[model samples]
Target chain A: MILTVTLNAALDITYHVPRLQPHTTHRVGEVVERPGGKGLNVARVLAALGHDTVATGLVGGRTGEALRAHLAAAAPGVVDALVPVGGETRRTIAVVDGESGDATMFNEPGPTVSAQEWAHFQDAYRELLIDAHVVALCGSLPPGLPVGSYAELVRTARSAGVHVLLDTSGEPLRRGIAARPDVIKPNAEELARLTGLTEPLRAAHEARRRGAYAVVASNGPQGLLAVTDEGTWRAAPPARFEGNPTGAGDAAVAGLLSALVEGLPWPERLARAAALSAATVLAPAAGEFDGAAYERLLPQIDTLP
Target chain B: MILTVTLNAALDITYHVPRLQPHTTHRVGEVVERPGGKGLNVARVLAALGHDTVATGLVGGRTGEALRAHLAAAAPGVVDALVPVGGETRRTIAVVDGESGDATMFNEPGPTVSAQEWAHFQDAYRELLIDAHVVALCGSLPPGLPVGSYAELVRTARSAGVHVLLDTSGEPLRRGIAARPDVIKPNAEELARLTGLTEPLRAAHEARRRGAYAVVASNGPQGLLAVTDEGTWRAAPPARFEGNPTGAGDAAVAGLLSALVEGLPWPERLARAAALSAATVLAPAAGEFDGAAYERLLPQIDTLP
Candidate 1:
């Protein structure tokens, strides 16, 4: 079973307006809500692709209940093992401009997790890992949790003989890589921030040397660059899909984890990651992909060594 | 007992950010939520001033539940007679720029009340009016309700021998005034929209001639201009208070109702309304007043003949 953890899950709300203007009143025409978090996004994509996935995170208050309800209704295939906390789960609002398709985001600070809650989550995670083959620690740590949260989770998964993928940024990612997760997927900007290298291949190699067994760096529209012990490869889709790119990276993570669990080669894994990500950009909402596009783009991906 | 009705109530959420720039994301530093709708605001202020006030309106779903929980905690003095509906309650967000103290508003269209729900509310309204000395019908008509909703409520209150105050704008106010409510409060803009007259005294007189026995026109920082059957008076605070004016009008409504219930003359009522309104502006959040300021400004109000 594949396990994904989102320490700071959110109830994502999208408000559609004719046009967005700052410091002016807007009467939203439509409102769309979904359960959101990096781990939840990846888990949904994996489950949709016929993989057995479990999602665990800390949720609390009425907002948490609403997020759980939305998850159950939206992704029935994924098992939920979320722990409850004291504070209300935060909400993230994306005001989408109907004309330009641009999004203005407002993120509420998520709930502060208590010591007991954090301890409880660690125990719950350990239990989930007992039956898990691979685990993905995703997103930022909510307030009150130590900055080394992802690092600790990486070590736990490694000790349990489960493959772990660390996908985060800044201090958490920096500290997490030191714990030597099996894989780390950072976009070009995150790669630069982590290794201070502008070139993708150089940065991916630096990240791998730091701790990860393999490093896959996303180069936005250009696609995926992978540096592994076996070999180095660059994978790109035949054509770039233009739409919302909100959850495209999460799709890449899901593809990588799914391919790894299936024991695919590094080149094949990159192809899968690039294709799934390109397909996700064509989707209207985040955490969703166009299945037909994914299937069509799979073989059209160019994988070069 | 004073009964206040908010047909289209809201969970008002305020987000404080350092600055508001168009097309850019904002990380809100503080989030303050309140149970809002003009009538509810009036009820809260009235209760705060030791008046027996009952708050009634439509609320539904999880957002409504949150609003109710907040109301129960914030205004324990006000009795809750709010009726439940099938649709989720709407939320209004005010993103306040800390730099300029300006607010950008986004209003979600509230739940549409079905015919059955409207009927249930009317029955509940009639029952509540039995023990009420005065009633205030406030705010907009949510979708799926007749535009003459306030008009119908005005007639119902009149039939129950309850003094009714209409405080709304646009077509509802136009239609509601013809029902001959005892009093009507219209802000400068709302007055112009209703009577198409920019002058406060002329517009107030025009509104009174249509159906209202009295008309109280709020002239922004200038204070209150009242036209009634007995006479006309203009009331102003000793000094203008500069602060948030979000709920100043609702505080004015509360003051007017409290004085009317006590059988105070028109001049005394205007003084109470103006002072309370001014004090509300000095408070940080809406539906609240600076008690010390309210007390200090009350006797200092100048009522002109």
Candidate 2:
């Protein structure tokens, strides 16, 4: 079973407005809500791909309840190992302009987890790690959690003999890479922030050098680049697709983790990751891939050495 | 006892952002949530002012639970007699720009009430009406509810010998007024839409002609105008106090109801209502009146004969 952890899971809301004008009241035409976070999104795809997955994190207040309810409805097969916290979980709003299809987002800073809550989560994560073949530590750490929380999670997963994929940015990534996780997935922007390199190849190489066993960098529509212990490979998309890009990186992470669990070669993993990432862009909303698109293009992605 | 009905209640959420830009994400600095709707706001102010009040409406799903929890925490004295429905209650978001103090609002159209849910609410309202002295039917009717629902509520309150005050807009206001509610409060623009008169005093008089025993119209900083069976009067604010005007009208409703329940004269009622309205503008956030501001301006408001 794969264990995905979202420290800052959110109740994602999308409000459809005719036009977005500043300093005016809007009558939203439609409202769509879903459970969201990088790890949750990854777990959603993983479950859809017929993988046994358990999602564990800190959930609290009414928003947390809503997130749990949605998770139950959206992915009934996936196990929910979420622990409780004191503060209300946060919500993120995406006000999508109906005319332009552009979205403006207002994201609430997630609840501050108490030190006690952090300890409780650690116990739960350690227990879940016992049965996990692979673990994915995803998203930013919420307030009150140590900056090296992801690093600690990586270490714990490693101690359990699980292949862990750490997907994050900034300080957490910098500290986590040092723990030598089995893999790390960073988009081009995050790669530059971490390795201070503009190029994906150099950034991934530099990231691997920092102790990551494997480094995968997603470069948007251009596709994915990977530097693994076996070899380095690149997978480029056949065409460009433009839509909501919010979940593309999470989809790539899902692809890489799925391939790792399947014991696929680096080239095959890179190809699937790139194609799935692009296919997610064509899906109607975030965190979902178009099966038809995925099937048609799955065989078209060409991996290069 | 005062019973305030908010058929289309919402979980009001305010997010403070440093600045707002289209198509960009904002990290909210603060998040404030409250149970809201015109009637709920009125109930809150009433409870704060030491009145016995009960808030009733339709609430369901996680948002509804949160709203009830907040109401319980904020006003323990106020009775929450809200009924349940099948759909999830809606949320309204106010994106407040920290630098400018300007807010952009996005309001969700509340849950669509099933026919069965509407019948269930009627039963609850009928039972509550027996113990109520005054009933305020407030805000928009949620979708799937009959447009004449407020009219029916006004008649029910009247049958129970309870004075009814109706505050709404458009067709709901039109149908509700024919029930001869003891009072009807409409803002300047809503009055213009309902009576086709841009002039405040003229609109108030015309609204009274439609069967409301009294008609009150809020005219922004200018204050309130009233046309009652006793006479026509205008209560002007002492001065303009600008802030979040979201709950000014609700505060005015609270003041008028407090005065009505006390059997105060029209002039005094208008003065208190106008003073409370201005005081609410001076108060931070919504549904609150600054006591000092209300005290300082109450005696100063000049009621024109």
Return the top candidate by TM-score: 1
TM-score of 2: 0.98
| lDDT per residue as tens, model 1, B38-96 | 99999999999999999998999899999999999999999999999999899998888
DockQ of each: 0.76, 0.90
Would you list the clashing residue pairs of candidate 2?
Answer: none
Question: Any idea what lDDT model 2 has?
Answer: 0.90
The docking category that best describes candidate 2 is high
Off by over 4 Å in 2: none
Worst 10 residues of 2 chain A by lDDT: A237-246
Clashing pairs in 1: none
The best candidate in terms of DockQ = 2
Model 1 chain A is weakest, by summed lDDT over 10 consecutive residues, at A279-288
DockQ, Cα level, model 1 = 0.76
Task: Kindly report which residue stretches of model 1 are placed more than 4 angstroms away from their true locations once superposed.
Answer: none
